[model samples]
Target: FYSELLHIIGLVETKVGGKRLIERNSEGQRHSGTILEDTIIHLDSLDKISRLSKAFIYGETHEERLFNVALGLNITWINRILFLKLLEAQLITYHKGDKSYAFLNLNRIREYDDLNRLFFQVLAVKHEIRNDDVKKLFEKVPYLNSSLFEPTEIEHQTLFISNLKDEKTIPALSNTVLKDEQGKKRTGSLSTLAYLFEFLNAYDFSSEGSEAIQEENKTLINASVLGLIFEKINGYKDGSFFTPGMITMYMCRETLRKTVVQKFNDLKGWSCVEFDELYNKIEDKKEANEIVNSIKICDPAVGSGHFLVSALNELIAIKSDLKILQDKDGKLLKFYDVEVENDEMIVTDEEGHLFEYNPK
Candidate 1:
């Protein structure tokens, strides 16, 4: 019902925007017209894609929540951040009253380098975005660029302006969302429905090759919000069941203390046989290193390697801190019986054979 309504709304919107509809065929082809051409794919399957499209287009509440929980990102927040970055790019021209902000388009901005131009254009589109709001977001730089959005060639100036100049302006592009390679504005039963349906269909089924899915007993959640709920029910929520917040904090504090102060205080004078002397009686270097350095602790309910993952992170953090200390002191630290080169831990065995512990 909503799908049909969306189709009607799209139809009405196209008429208002003065664009005609079109049809598409398989072999990945499209044609402009009022009537839609039937192909191998059916309307029922297309309806499924239509529904998913609504999730992105209408910005469904559940879908928004899903993005936040699963991806640790809010769409609006990301959009705003991009807007600010776009504003920064445009600040030089702000004094001249030349405004262009492309990030507000809610459509794709290919020329990342022309962020300022995009910002100016976006600011010019009074119906789509407001200048005041853009300015407000610019004022508050809440976050810094991470690995995902760090500036690149097209994002930086030289290539940015070059690409911006190459972009073509098409009529009715705002209402006409989809486009061809030549930037010809698309008009028709939106091809996004077909593309989206095919994508969703491909992802809907669980693959036998997916180890994570194969290991879990229950059905997977297709959506993110549901996945968070499922994750909570399945004992991966806050990881509290494995390590309660307070206990996790205490454990972290104790581990940090141990790393800094060396809790083997009482055993200062107590010298057991050297690892090599003790291991000389043992069979292999593998068994010797296991006895000497590594500690194996198991979680009671070991679902999804949660405890193990965190433990690994904590251990790596300790090692990193030690490395920093060694670098500062210009000498090896207490944890330096083994040397880590190119991420491989190399230990000298009893007979001076180098045993490599390579975690891959």
Candidate 2:
């Protein structure tokens, strides 16, 4: 059996809880120490990598000794440079070993930066890239964008489900779940259709705001958004992957700049503040109640719930502000204008489109 297998099977222990045996030559001519508590042996093969032999050889040693060996600014410089590259990319993480000898996950680092870039590099270099490359690439992507870019939906979902096998996973909640008692198991299914529900309803599915989209082309628009997000989770055909998260976020920010941020900036000065104040002039607005009634957000992938949850949270905030405005203007029929917590779709005036239970 191999050293690792034998060690795992306890046939001949190698590492004793992360420490190995220390052997020496009594007179620089023969083996000195016992292989076990009572057994003694003379060395026959010097280069064999058996568990018994590995028990005598230690893993990489303390950092101080490593540093001592790397001194004179030669080897240490290279190590430091590599370490700094990882640190800059925020790829370095606590490893399994003494502080003097740290272990790092280079694959995870690569996966984090640009999964696509890392995938091609790994594929090109035989499914493994240098640990340094992985770490360096991940540090450049924003955490949110990185979280969203799954190389493939199936593979990514497999990883996610693997990570959360024992945990309760959830997407958006249904009205029944919203009304469920605290600490109770709130059950619901996730569907791709839900992705377009809010977007369609928010703009009334009209052509004025989202002119790039046509009324009759609702399915296409829906498909486009869902398809893009799905591709982000999975990959496009030919095994290509999503753009790096940092670049993706930058693009998103640039494209939606005027619509989200610059528009807020334009509503500047006292007028903006007054607008905000007027917006929140709810007559019976109880601060504690509002806080308690704050909206909830969810992301299906919830690979740390970056994009979907952020969008949901922002929309809720806007909804809250709008609710306050409605209240002051004697339109405070409900605590909020939209009861997202209990959003039940009632087919009104239209036909053919029916509801279905979809678990994504």
lDDT of 2 by residue, 173-271 (tens): 232212225645335432212211222222211121122434333332221233233333222112223333344344433333223333443433223
Give each model a TM-score. Answer: 0.21, 0.19
- TM-score between model 2 and native: 0.19
Q: In candidate 1, what are the lDDT values of residues 102-182, reduced to their tens digit?
A: 222223333333344333433334433445544444332223333333433212311122222222221222343335567
Q: Best candidate per TM-score, number?
A: 1
Least accurate stretch of 10 residues (summed lDDT) in model 2? 34-43
* Candidate 2 wrong stretches, greater than 4 Å: 1-115, 118-146, 150-209, 212-219, 223-289, 292-322, 325-360
Q: What are the lDDT scores of the predictions, listed in order?
A: 0.31, 0.28
Give the runs in model 1 whose Cα sits over 4 Å from its true position.
1-250, 253-292, 324-360
